[model samples]
Target: AQSVTQPDIHITVSEGASLELRCNYSYGATPYLFWYVQSPGQGLQLLLKYFSGDTLVQGIKGFEAEFKRSQSSFNLRKPSVHWSDAAEYFCAVKLVRGSTLGRLYFGRGTQLTVWP
Candidate 1:
């Protein structure tokens, strides 16, 4: 079964600090990776994704992610943290092929707190 794992359940960072949210997936083959942010009482917003092409993909809001096949990891990073960036981050995977093609699997989610 394919699944995504976010090691940190909650993270607290001071404003202007660097941020890194870890994401790891378990699948037989490489799967499409996605990072989504959900604000309080809001729907999920796409932050970034990694399907193919470059190993490092830039996303909205100064966010970026690197896909490492050898590590089975697609970790999200930002040089600086903002209070507005505080939200629940979820790591997801989508199957491009096989019987469950296009099926999306999500991680438990990581809650972020930014202190000013």
Candidate 2:
């Protein structure tokens, strides 16, 4: 069984400041990892994913993440934050094996608040 955990239930950052959201996962083997953001009354949009290769992966909206196997973590980072970036962020994981969409799981949810 694969699972994802996001420690922070909410985070507040000033506009134009750096931000980082923590994420951890539990899986038997290398799993597909993702960071998604959802605005109020909107759908989740893929921020990034780790399938293979380089640990560092770039995502939309100037976001990026690093896959740390030892720590079982894939944390999201953005050097500068914006008012528009304030939203809910979710960490999700799925088996690298194909046809396992049913195994995908998401975190409780992390609300990001940005102050101007």
Candidate 3:
């Protein structure tokens, strides 16, 4: 069916190191995909999204994602990760049932730990 998968449960990185979080989705149609980050004891923050055109989408907090339709993936990337970037990252996709109303289906998040 339609779902999102984050293969890595947790990842550790050094401060100023590059980071990449894998995201995969299965959908029949052109999917509305999003990446979000949640800091500890805080609400989720929208990172980036992909609907159509220009596979590469820029997002806040120096984050970006490339949507690969051929591979059915939207992998998140950061050139360099800061210690403050330590948080839980989630991959999500919108699904519409019946009418135009849509709901989000999220993948199990990837926890990033940044060490000095």
Candidate 4:
């Protein structure tokens, strides 16, 4: 079964600090990787995605993710943290070939706290 794992359920960082949310997936073949941010009382927003071609993909809001096939990981990173950046981050994976194609398998989610 394909699944996404986010090791840290909650992380706290000071404003202007660097942020990294770990994500790992389990799949036979390389599947699509995505990072989504869900602010309080808001819907999920696409932060970045890795479909193919590039190992490192840039996303919205100064976010980026590197796809490492050897580790089956697609971790999201940011150079600086902002108060507004505090939100719940979720890592998702989608299979290319299967009955569940196009269905996103999401991680449990990581709650980020930014302190000023």
Candidate 5:
């Protein structure tokens, strides 16, 4: 079965600092990877995804991730952070199947607290 694990349950950062969040997955073959961020009481916004091709993929909100097949990792990184970036982040994997768009299995989530 496919699954994801996010080691950090919560993280805190100061405004204007850099940030990185870890994500690891277990799958038989190459899996679709994604990172999403959710503000308080809001739906998740896609940060980035790794479907195929290049190991490094970029996404909205100045976020990027590198897919490491060897490590079974896809970690999200931001060069610098903003106060508004404070939110809950989730790492997800889309199940690989023949027909349907498979369901996404998400990590428990990491709560990010930004200090002024």
Candidate 6:
């Protein structure tokens, strides 16, 4: 069985502080991993993805993540936090969908709070 877990339910950081959101997954083998962000009223937006090749993948909005196969973890990070960055972040895994677009299995999500 493949599952995603975001241990931290909520995290608060200063406007210019560094931020790190933890994510862990349980899968039989190396799986497709992703990180998504959801604002108050907006739909989920892809922050980054790790399909193959480089383990350290760059994403939009000055965000980045590293996929560690040994520990089955894909954690998200940002050098500095911003007031507008406050949102609910989710870690998800893509599952094969048999000839169709793969389905996404998301974690409970970690809510980010940035204080100015």
Candidate 4 deviant stretches above 4 angstroms: 97-101
lDDT of 5 by residue, 1-116 (tens): 66799999999999889999999998887778999999999999988888889999999999999999999999999988999999999999887644466888899999999899
**Model 5 per-residue lDDT at 105:** 89
Task: Provide the RMSD of all predictions against the true structure, rounded to 1 decimal.
Answer: 1.8, 1.4, 1.9, 1.8, 1.4, 1.6
Clash statistics: count for each candidate: 0, 0, 0, 0, 0, 0
lDDT tens string, model 4, 7-113?
A: 99999999999999999999999988889999999999999988889899999999999999999999999999999999999999988745554789999999999
- Per-prediction TM-score to the true structure, in the order listed: 0.94, 0.93, 0.94, 0.94, 0.93, 0.94
What does candidate 6's lDDT look like per residue over 20-64, in tens digits? Answer: 999999978777889999999999999999988899999999999
lDDT of 3 at 5: 94
The global Cα lDDT (0 to 1) of model 2 is 0.92
Please estimate how well model 6 matches the true structure, expressed as its whole-model Cα lDDT. Answer: 0.92
Residues forming the 10-long window of minimal summed lDDT in candidate 5: 94-103
- The TM-score between candidate 1 and the true structure equals 0.94
TM match of model 2 to true structure: 0.93
The sequence of per-residue lDDT tens digits that candidate 1 reaches over residues 1-116 is: 66799999999999999999999999988988999999999999999988899999999999999999999999999999999999999999997744554878999999999999
lDDT of 3: 0.92
TM-score of 6: 0.94
Residue 96 of model 1 has an lDDT of: 78
Worst 10 residues of 3 by lDDT: 94-103
Poorest lDDT segment (10 consecutive residues) of candidate 4 = 94-103
Tell me the deviation in Å of residue 2 in model 4: 2.5
Local accuracy by lDDT, each model:
0.94, 0.92, 0.92, 0.94, 0.91, 0.92
Q: Which residue runs does candidate 1 get wrong by more than 4 Å? A: 97-101
